[model samples]
Structure formats: C-alpha cells, structure tokens
Target: MSESGASPAKIKKLDPTEEVHETREYDPETQKALEEIDSCQNEIDQLNEKASEEILKVEQKYNKLRKPNFENRSKIIQRIPNFWVTAFVNHPQISAILEEEEEECLHYLTKLDVEEFDDIKSGYRIKFHFDENPYFENEVLTKEFHLGSTGDPASQSTDIKWKEGHNLVERFRQRMQQGEKGGTGRKRPLELRSFFSWFSDHGDPSADEIAEVIKDDMWPNPLQYFLVPDIEVENGEGDDDEEELEDEEVDDNVVVVEEEIEEVDEEGVEEEEEEEAPGEEDGEADE
Candidate 1:
C-alpha cells in the first residue's frame, strides 16, 4: 500500500505442519477446580516460606546466645589446671569404664580436641595430647572414626596414629628389650589400645547405657548436651510401670492355672470317695 513498497510484498502465511498442535480448552468446572488447586498450592508455598524464615530467625538467635556461653566456658576450663583430668575422674560413669592402669596416664592429658569432616565424608577425628610421660614417645595421638551414610557407629571404621616425641622412641626400645628378655614382646603400648577402645565403645551402646555416657564431659559433641532433653526421667518411670504390669499379668496367669489344677484334683477326690462309700455299704449289707 506504500508508495515505494508495491502492495506490502503480498503478506505471507504460516502453513500448518505435522509439528503444529492445537491447545486444549478445559470446561468451566474443571478450569475452576484447577484454579483452586493452583491457588491452594501458592498459599501453601507462602506459608512454608514464612515458617522457614521464622525457623531461621530462631536458629540465628540461639547461635548468638550460645557463642558467648561457649566462650565463657572455654575461658573457665583454660584457667583451671588438670581440669580435664578432674572432670573425667569426678564422673562416676566415665571412671567406671576406664582401667585402673589408665588413671595415671590420663592425669598427664593436656588437651583433647575433636574435629569433624562433613564435606568430604561423614567422620570425626579425636586428638589427645599428653605431657612428657614414661610410657610412649608420642605426645599426641589421633584416632579417626569414619561413619556410614546413615551415621551408624556400628558401621564405622577407625584408624590410630601418633607423632613421635623425643624420649618415646628410646623408651619404647628399652621396653622392647625388657619384653624380649621376659619372652613377652608387644607391638604397641597397651595404654594406646585401652584409650582408643574406651572412646570407640561409647560410639554405640545400649539405650539405657548410653544415657550415662552422654552425661559425661568426655562425650565429644557439645551439641549433644543441649539437643537431648531430660526425657529419660519420665521414660524411666514409664519403664517401671511397664515392668510392673508385665509382672502382674504373669501372676494372674499363674493363679488361673493353679485354680484349674485344684478343680481337677477336687473332682478326682470326689469320685474316689463315692466309689469307696458304695463298697462300704455293700460290705455292711453282706455282714
């Protein structure tokens, strides 16, 4: 239509091909239902987002409160000499699990550190540092625990290694010589095995047994302290009640069985008495 375009070059149309498809038109009721569903979904999404934001805020507040408290605790522990030793010794549950020979060596313990590697894999490394001791040449010993995907301690793997100190190698050599003379040679110090075993044993324990373990300071996880509530107090009472109920049920069954046995005995005695009476009457009549 333009003066220089010659009728707009004849407008071209899109020819329908096999790939072309028609759009479906839903009925009024179905369209309304779909709209309602979409509205509900949007509402749910909004509520979830709001809830997550609130939860995050609460978690942030908790962390802010926890940080200072933890710092203060660390300061207090640092100020006290032999604090770790005293803490472990004072706890009856922890003391009971340790060997008598280990008590002296644990006194030399200067530091205990636990590190977690969650990025590469789920695992923990426990490091223990001790002062100069006559036992082994290693001042620092590390034990690692590699956990499964499910975080089960029963399926964990462990590795033990140590760094050599100045006097440890010489002391170990002397011990080996002594042991060789006595016809008793050891590959490693028994103390190392004992310490590792104690820690590893706590990884998985019976529910009742684990309660005591978690209360001790030796438990590496600080989160464990606040995360697990004191529900065991009520659970203990419930367990006692269940035990009492079971005992009562057993007693009731025993009483029922005894009553049935007494009834059978009484019936047999009555029949014997009836037969003896007839014999006596017949004998008297003959006389």
Candidate 2:
C-alpha cells in the first residue's frame, strides 16, 4: 500500500504483442485446452480441404456429363431466330449493362459458348459467335478469366477488329476525353461502358457480373429466358395491353367531354338571359 492509504494500482494488462507475459496468468489446464482447440481447428481445416476435393470431383464429373446435352441444345437453339440475343436481353444481370446499341449489335450474335477450364476452380471462358453484320469484323470473340491460387483474378479478351466508325468502347474513351465535371469520366471505369465494350474491358475482373450471369444462370437454363416473350403472348397479354390503352384513351375523352358539357351549359344560360331581357322590356312598356 502507498503512503497515501490507497492500494497500489495493479499492473495494466497489455496486449500480447505489446508486452509478452512469459508467466501467463492462465492455469496449465486452460493453456492446454487452448492448445487442443488449435489442434481441433487444424483437423477441421484438413477435413474442409478433403471435402473441397470431393466437391471438385463431383463438379468435374457433372460438367463433362452436361457437355453433350449442352451441345445438342445449342443446335436446337440455332433453329430459333435471335435466340441468344433475346435470352441475353431477358437476363436481368446482362440486360443491366446492355443498351440500345449493344442490343442491336447482339442481334447478330447467333451462338454463345461458355467453357470452364479443366480445373474449374482456375477459371472459365466465354465465347460469342456472331454473323457478319454492320458491327466489328470479328466473327468470334472470346474472353478468358484465370483465377490464381492466391485468389487473384486475371482476364484477357480478344482484340476487337472494329470496322470504320464502329467501336463501342470509344464511347467511354470519348467521355473520358470530354472530361466530365467531377473528373470521373477521365477515370475510365468499366462499369459505365455498354455490352460489347465490356468484352474489351480488362478492368474490374473480380466484378465480371455478366460472365457470372452467363455461366451460373443462363448457360444452365437459357430456355426459360428465351420463352419469356412466348409466355406473355400465350397469356393473351397483347389483348390485355390493347384493352388498357383503350381504357386510358376513353378516360382521357371523358375529361374532354366534361369540359365540353360545361361550355354548353354556360352558352345555354347566356341564351336564356337574352330571351328574358325582351320579356322584361315589354312588361316595363305595359306598366
């Protein structure tokens, strides 16, 4: 105890890194328990690694099995006009990046192929096959993404052979050249660019949203999106839309009719007043 009659303050506990307590206050049993917990964690990690390996084997097996069916489906899809483009536009994720120009350009996209590399975890590639159109000269455009062991993603895409005055990516470059108010345009972020331009983009590889959408969603079940318009048509949606338009027109005309009725009522009242003036004058002359 200090001379001031107060108990001496106990030594402040420091963080493990700040000051190592060679003589740990924990009991031997507690220390041994912590060691056991670490050992348990190591075992769990080993089990998780084994489970991942098993999952990978299953994925590889199913991926190969699904290949032939996918090829057959592609052949059938070719029979349908504008199948790939329609499916893409219907996709919620892909459609977000697509604009009118991209949609029109994609009309020429006859086939789309998404292939995973042998090591599925490594990465995958998306190939777009287009017919000769007013767009770029490349009939086949392929983009590949490679994810390394360290969790870093790298991607490369085919250089677009744009015809004269047909570069979509220029839209972003142009915006950058023009220099937006906040210097954001000059930053040249890939997110602002439209569809085909995105293929050329190498930035933001981790956020390759459209590729993920194609692989995880559209590749497995594209027919669902392809049949969207057909479903709407089958449900008499066209007729319903027409009826709604007609109802809106009728509502508009009703408002116009009410205005005309008010005008006529005012005119009728003015005519009645004019007739009463002659009667009043005749009565006054008689008096």
Candidate 3:
C-alpha cells in the first residue's frame, strides 16, 4: 500500500533489454556428466528436505516443553516496572526506530509474546500486551506473518484503535507532511521511523528486520536486555567512566595539597631552630 492509504498501481512496465537466458551446447560426454551432476544435486536437496522436517519436529517439541517456563518467566517479569519497554529499548536495532514518544508509549507494554504457527515454517505472530494507557484502546495488539500455500509471503496486523490525539503514527505522518511544507525543528530520517508505523505495517513481512531481531535475538533471551544497564556499568561502558576519571583527578589534587603543606611545616621548623640557636649564642657571650 502507498502512504496515502491506497494500494500501489498493479501495472509493472518492463524496460526493454537484450538479455536472454540460453542453455549452452555441450559435447555428448559432457552432457552425460552434467546429468550425473544434476542427479547428485537432487539427492542433496532430498536430504535437505528431510533434515528440515526433523528440525521442525524438534522445534515443535521444544516449544511445547518451553511453554510452562515462558509463562513462569512472564509472571516474574510482570513484577518489574516497564520490563518489556526497557528490554525492547535496549535492543540495538529495535531502539533505532523508537523515538522519544514511542519509548514513553512502550512503558505501557506489560508483556510480549511471539508464537510460531503450527507448521513453524508457514508463519508466526507477535503479540504485545499493554496496561491501561493514554495511547490506544487495545490491550493486546497482534501482527502475523504468513507464507501462503503457493510460497508467497504476506503480513497482517491488528488495527490500532487510537485514543483521541494520542496516535503517534498519525503524529509522525503529520510531522512528515509539515516538514514537506517547510515547517520543522528537525525531521526524522527514513531510518528513524515511528514504532507505531512498524506495528501497523503489513508490507513485505519477510523483509521486516525488526521482526526478525525481536524474534531471533530479543525474544529468546530478553533477560540480557533487561540487565543491559547493569551490564554496561560492569563493563565501564558509560558515563560512569567519566566519573571514575573525575575521582582520580580529585585524588591527585588532594595529594598535591598535602605535599605543599608538609613542605611549609618543614620550613617553619627550620626557622624556629635558627632563632633558638641565635638566642643561645647571646646567653653564652653574656656569661
């Protein structure tokens, strides 16, 4: 669909080209060898297909095994304040698309779940559960990706019913429109797009980079992301590094002052000794 809420034009005009595919002529012996190579490739493909089936069976079994654990983990995660949002924002690729408002909006997100369809290879869906918030009316928003029987990939999402004046997606669109009209403080680039748009997006699901990142990277071990801030502190990777440097500078200044004080005290004692020696010499001369 186009940005204006309309489907794209169906007609695809092909450019004129001289390129053509042609099979190369080979000698009889070479052709026989080629046929043998093709047979070998077919066998390899058959083995690959069998391997895929076995892998899917294993995945299904494990998914069943992991269900109880995931539920228990979710129970604990709900106790933490803004757990999902924190983890989502800590994710490198996911964070890139999240603007300030989107980050705040995600605070309402209570839980997140991504489920593979029964076939596993056919499709998957990501579900977002939210607390009562000002952004929208939906408690749970879902986006599904599917591979059709014909092997065509498609995506669909729950329509976000926005609360009055709280649609960040619409806000972004308005900002883009305004920016086009030469009214702007700063315009977001294509890369820094709105998160809400991503949620509602149905285009080219197979190419959805954030979806893959969340499913493969963020979902499997969200605890790592939840502990991202602590991890960074442990690694000396943030503003704390500057603070440590400042403390060192303060310690050096204190050492310099102490040394100066010791030098002054030694000079004072030397002066007192010189005065006492002069007084003793005077007393001896009088006697």
Candidate 4:
C-alpha cells in the first residue's frame, strides 16, 4: 500500500450468525429437487458402467469359445479335398439351381473366393478359378456386384471379366496360332446377371430378371458361413448429456457478464451522487 500510495483492499469475514442467515435464503424444496436430480444422474451413471462391463465380459467369452470352433472347422476342411464344393453340390437348394452341363463345368471348379469392397454393405466380388478345361481359354473369371444405398442385396450395376492365363492345351493352341486363324477369337465378356441366371437356370436370361435371382437369393447368404460375424455397438447417452451441459454453461456465463455490467453502472452513479453532495453544501454556505 505505501509503494503504490493506495489503501490495500480489506476482506470482510462473515460472523456465524450471518452465515446462518445466508443459508435461510435457499428454499428447502428447491434444494431437495436439485439433490434428487444429482442422485438420479449418479445412479444412471453407475448402471451404465456396470452394463458396459457385463457386455465386455460376454463378448470376451464369446470370442474365446468361437476361436476353437473356427480352428477345428478349418482343420477339418483342410483334410477334406473339395470339401466346400462337395457340400454346395449336395445342398438341395444349390443342386436345384444347376443343370447337367453347368454341373459338369462346376466339377472343374477348383477354387471359389469372395472379396468385400471398402464399404462392406456396398458391394462384393466373386471369383471362380477352374482347372484346365475344354470350354474356354480363360482360367479365372471374376464378377463384382454393386449394392444399393438401402443395403439391398440386388445390385444396380454388375461387372464381369475374364483373367488371362493359358491352360496346357491353350498354350499349345497359342503356339499354333500362325495358321489361317492366326488370332484365336476373343471370348466376349458376358453380363454378370445374365451369366449367373443362365448358369443357374440354363435358359435365356435378361439383366432385370436375373438381378433378384443372383443378388437376393444366391451370393450373400450362401457365403455367410465364411465371413466373420459383425460386432454390435451400443449408443452412448453420456455424450448427449455432456453436450447439453456445455450449452447450459455457456448460458450461465452470459448471465454473469450482464450482472457484472449492471454492478459497474450502479457504482458509477453512486460516485457522481457523492461528488454532487459536496458542491450543494458549498452553494448553501455562499447563500
């Protein structure tokens, strides 16, 4: 205070009686309502935490059980040659879909692979690899199907293409291409829907008519056994409550600022009244 030539601010201590009077200003009913809200929130938080812990325990148990079952299945399939193919052929629904000629071609099928795209629900690819056969020169055929935004199995667009790899007979055939038919005729790329329908029905097929047959009934569900199970996620209610709390805090800050501005204005008016009182006393003395 001596360095600045200004008086130090004094802090007033409240008496015990004054503290008691201050407590009387709060309504009991209002205080109880606030306490009840806090209690309910605490209970909800505890229950949510316990539920999350239980869910995690169940998931861990499921994974522990699932791993051994998957390992056993994999070992069995490895021991059995063409195990998946044999199973598909024996299935009543699948057997009903194949014709005599198609069944003959299917028997040459050595490998089947399915690949999901970046967005799992968006699309997938089905690839068929065959052994050396007399039907065509291509060794691998791939088909990609695009799904709708609504997660419908029926695709709006389909891409079908043949990968190049010559069979033993095809290699000899390529060497003999110097004759009158030097270039072997290129096999035309078939439309995905038409090919699957013709393969399934052994009849003339159209794009629209085959869409439901291949996408909805065939590809997705039949290959589900090979895909990993999707994990389920719970919605977080705490995040919503936190956002609401942040909004309330912002409103309280605005009210505090307004109250501070009003207090400053009232202090300025009191200073002006005190300055005028001395001027009025001097005017009365001059009279």
TM-score of each: 0.35, 0.67, 0.70, 0.31
Put down candidate 2 lDDT per residue, 1-287, tens digits, no spaces.
12232211223357867964444355677666755665666678779989999999998999999999989998998899999889987776677667666688889988888999888889999989999998789999999999758767889999998888877677546754785422221233344666776788788677787778888899889999989888888888779778999999999999999999999999999999999999999999999
Ranking by TM-score: 3, 2, 1, 4
- lDDT per residue, candidate 1, 15-73, as tens digits? 86544244446777876675566566667877997997787677567656665665566
Is 2 or 3 the stronger prediction by TM-score? 3
lDDT of each: 0.53, 0.79, 0.81, 0.50
Off by over 4 Å in 4: 1-80, 150-287
Best by TM-score: 3
Give candidate 3 regions above 4 Å deviation: 1-31, 149-151, 180-192, 238-287
**51-140, model 3: which lDDT tens digit per residue?**
999999999999999988988988999999999888977877787677677788899998989898889988899999999999889999
| Model 3 residue 157 distance off true place after TM-score fit, in angstroms | 1.0
Candidate 1, residue 206: how far the Cα is off, in Å:
10
TM-score of 1: 0.35
Q: Name the candidate, 1 or 4, with the larger lDDT value.
A: 1
Looking at model 2, residue 63 earns an lDDT score of 91
- Model 3 scores worst on lDDT over the 10 consecutive residues at 1-10
Please report, as a residue range, the 10-residue window in candidate 1 with the lowest summed lDDT: 1-10
